[model samples]
Target: MKAISYSRYGGPEVLEYGDLREPKVGPDSVLVKVRAAAVNPVDWKAREGYLDPVLDAVFPVVPGWDVAGVVVGLGASVTEYAVGDEVIGYVREDFLSRGTFAEYVGAPVRTLARKPRNLTWEEAAGLPLTGLTAYQVLVKALRVQRGETVLVHAAAGGVGSIAVQLARHLGARVIGTANERNHDYVRSLGGEPVTYGEGLAERVRGLAPEGVDAAFDTIGGDTLKVSAQLLVPEGRLVSIADGDVVSYGGRYSFVRPDADDLTRLAELAEQGVVSVHVFETFPLERAADAYRRNEEGGTRGKIVVTVAWDTAGPDA
Candidate 1:
């Protein structure tokens, strides 16, 4: 099988495209013939060894977690899906290796969900991680309610865009921060746009007047600090980027794989309540380029890497 992998932790420069053995399907996993994979900041961060303390890295690591693909084979114990089923997964295992950047991935059933029929493979690939992050933070962590005003940091980026839509779906008024260029994009996602930096708190205050009922921060640093002040005295706040949010009486949320949650997100996509914007797409072999683009930041949506499979074999 052809895959992109690195034998050592480094930058995108370390990534190599070549043949590798196909992943094994365990009792609780299914083998997905990769159609497309999405690049998240965590992909590049993991490549740079930032997640080493928490995720064990094996040599020749394949670096991707979000995949939209077809099930080609299934484990003896797998019953949720079968051959020919199109699925999307956040295929993060307990260790770092055998990831979705390959022609195939052995995804545990817990990580798999039926891909939204309304989305293209690239868009479906983009949704699992970022969509789940937004859904979990707003719906579960912050418990945003109807008629509430909520603030989302980095609202034009992947997760924040989804957060904006989800908050609006829940009947909350969304105030989102982005650059001046993305202000209209944020508004299109149903958020009242506010430019980030220096006076973010004041801008949010002007939008909400009485302070926001909840805040979801995807950008760290002083943005989280600003979120703390923009919230009412007892408002809920959560950050996916900063752990120090705990110190500000807010929660730090790390996205986890939940088939039920992923299914709900798919439902939202199918219902036209939320949609993924693909900022760009690259061929599988050009994954390193995708990583470089993601690292450059300021992307309005997700970046996807498409895998072309030959009927005879993997990229035959």
Candidate 2:
């Protein structure tokens, strides 16, 4: 099968488009005929060895986590889906080898969910990882409540965009930090936008003088620190970007692949309670360019890689 892979950790330059052997499906996994994959910062970070401390990289690594595809074959022990089922998944494992940036992927049932029928392939591919991050952090980690004022950093980015919408649905008033250009975009997502940097704390205070009831920090470093200070007494805080959040009396969250959670997100998507924005997309062979675009940052949403499958074969 054709896939994007790298033998050694480096920049996007390390990525190669070539043929790799088909994945062997386990009893709990299914073989998905890949339609589209989304590029997350983690994809490029993992490519550069930044996540080496946690995730083991099996060399010749195929790097991608979010996918929307169709089930071509079911595992012997699987009863949840049929051969023609369309699905979306956060197709990650403890190790990196076989991944979603390929013509096909062996995705475990634990990470798969029926795709939202209303979404385009690229939008469905963009939803899994980022949507889960926002859902888990808001619903579980932050325990955001109705009528609370919550602040989200990087409001126009993938996770923050979803966070704003979900929080509003949960009855919370959202305050999001974004550039001047994205203020209207954030407002469209149901957030009151505040310009980041310098007087960020003052700007947030201008919106909620009593201080926010919860804060979701997507940018680490100084932004995380500012979020810590913006909270009301005992206000909740969580960070997916930095583990140091624990030091500020906040929790550090890492999104895990859970079929139940993914299903809920899909339901919400189909119901129009949430949506994904595709900032851009590239063909599978130009996946390296997608990585480069993601690394450049400031994208409003996900960058996707699409596979042009042929009835002829994998290479075609």
Candidate 3:
């Protein structure tokens, strides 16, 4: 099977595209024929060796976690899905290797969910990681309730955009921070747009004068500090980007795979309560380009890598 992999940790330059043995389906896993994969900042960060301390990386590592594909084979214990089932998964295993950036991935049942029928394959691929992140932080960590006010940092980016929609879906009034150019986009996601940077806290205060009930930070740094000040004394705060949030009495959230949670996200997508925006897409062989685009940052939505199994061209 064809896949993109790297034998050593480095930048996108180290990625090599070629043939590799197909992944093995274990008793708790299913082999999926990849249709599309989404690029997350973590993909590039892992390539640069940032996650080495936490995730062991075997040589010739395939670097993707979000995939929308069809199940081609299933493990003996995998009763939740069968061959020919279209699914989406945040296929992060205990170790780094045999990832979704390939023609096939052996995904554990815990990581798989039926793909939202309402979404395009690229959109479905984009949802798992970002949707799970937003859901975990807001619904689970912050416990945002209806009629409350919530502030989301980087509101127009991949995860933030979903956070904005999810917060609104939960009946919370959402205030999102983005660049001047993305303010309108944030508003379209049902968030009251506030320009980020220097006076972010003040801007949020102006929008929710009584003080926000919670805050979700996708961009770390002083943004966490700003969130701390913008919230009410006991307001919850969660950050996906910074661990130092603990010092501010806030929780640092790391997204994990859960079939139940992924299913709920799919339900939300099917109900039109949330949607994924695909800012751009590249063929599977051009995955390095997808990483470069994600690294440049400030994309309004997700970047996807489409797979074409029937052809030998770049699109294939």
Cα lDDT computed for each candidate against the true fold: 0.92, 0.94, 0.92
Whole-model lDDT for model 3 versus the true structure?
A: 0.92
Choose 1 or 2, whichever is better by lDDT.
2
TM-score of predicted model 2? Answer: 0.98
In Å, residue 165's CA in model 3 sits off its true spot by: 0.7
lDDT tens readout by residue for model 3, 65-168: 99999988889998899888999999998788888999989899999899999999999999999999999998999999999999998899999999999999
Clashing pairs in 3: none
Q: For candidate 2, what is the total of clashing residue pairs?
A: 0
Candidate 2's residue-wise lDDT over 135-212, tens digit each? 999999999999999999999999999999999999999999999999999988999999988999999999999999
TM-score for all models, in order of appearance: 0.98, 0.98, 0.97
Predictions: Cα RMSD each: 1.1, 1.2, 2.3
State residue 119's C-alpha deviation in candidate 3, in Å: 0.5
TM-score, candidate number 1: 0.98
